[model samples]
Target: MKLSSEQIKQKLKDAGLRVTPQRHAILEAVYTLGNHPSAEQVIDFIRVRYPGIATGTVYNVLDVMVESGLVKRVKTDKDAMRYDAIMNRHHHIYCAESDRIEDYFDEELDELLQAYFRKKKLQDFKIEDIILQIKGNFNDNSE
Candidate 1:
């Protein structure tokens, strides 16, 4: 979901966060790049147009955004943390070799997992979210 600067500001305001130029640029960079990006990737993107923005500033902005529910933090099996712009419920397909991530949404799979867990009925544990990371290599030439 691409958002204009004004819309991004409004989103931040709605989330009870102050809208700043750095935050706006960071959010815009994440939105523009649909693929899950690491902190360094975000910094590189922001630096192209926002040369003055510091790497630390980008990381801080991302942390605030994730905490405020404006973005999501995806953790791969390899322990690498990636930032996702889309807040909606979804899974990911992670490419091990390239460290690329792609969104995946499957209603049936979600329902199956929910039903299985409900039947199992683990005590004292609550499932907040389920994000499956299917690890593999992305075939670029094959559809």
Candidate 2:
């Protein structure tokens, strides 16, 4: 899921953001890290390329990105905040033991859930996006 620098700048443009060295590097970092990176993880990654970048800058950029729907946030059971670069609608498979999160996409399941929820038609609640966090061990091969 790697993106070229031009593609990264295009994403920023689409998000109506001005492209700066830090913004470009941060967006690329989010995609390159590719592990639902936390703020700390993103900072570490950006720091390698941008040694003088500030922690606050990274956090502020992440907030802006999230607000613009450039990335989605994932919180582990331990309350660790993580960021996902994949913008498409998808859920997560969380492994508690390893603290790893993987994207899961199932169109049929999405349709089923949507239909079920639509049938309920709860008042005063607008369904914006459906996200599910499935928690378990990734390598559970026990008999």
Candidate 3:
């Protein structure tokens, strides 16, 4: 899901954000990393090439990206904030032992949850999006 420089610039423009070198590098780092990375990790990645980028700039760009719907912030059970570039409706599978996060997409699961919540109908409450972060370890069948 890594975006090219041009694609990143186009996304910024579409989101009404002015494209800058820092934003371009930050967005590219998030998408290229694939695995959800915390702000520190993003800074480390970008610092390799753009040593002049400050920590505040990275955080600011990430905040703007989240506000503009270009990226989503994933908070783990440990309260570590990570970034995800995928904007589609999907859940996540988090492995505690390996500290890995994988995307899980199931239309059936989404429909079931929506139906159940609709039936419950909490008074005066509106449902936004459902996030199910299943945490566990993956067993290797080959072993």
Against the true structure, whose TM-score is highest? 2
Superposed Cα deviation of residue 53, candidate 1 (Å): 0.8
lDDT of 2 by residue, 1-143 (tens): 78999999999999999999998988999999998999999898888767999989988999999999898888887776889889888999988777878899999999999999989987999999989989888776343
Poorly placed runs, candidate 3 (over 4 Å): 140-143
Which pairs clash (backbone N, Cα, C closer than 3 Å) in model 2?
Answer: none
All candidates: CA RMSD (Å): 2.3, 2.1, 2.2
Q: Could you tell me every candidate's TM-score relative to the true structure?
A: 0.89, 0.94, 0.91
Error of 1 at 117 (Å): 1.9
User: What lDDT would each prediction earn against the true structure?
Assistant: 0.86, 0.89, 0.90
Q: Judged by TM-score relative to the true structure, which candidate is superior, 1 or 3?
A: 3
TM-score of 1: 0.89
Ranking 1 against 2 by TM-score, winner: 2
Off by over 4 Å in 2: 140-143
Residue pairs of candidate 1 with colliding backbone atoms = none
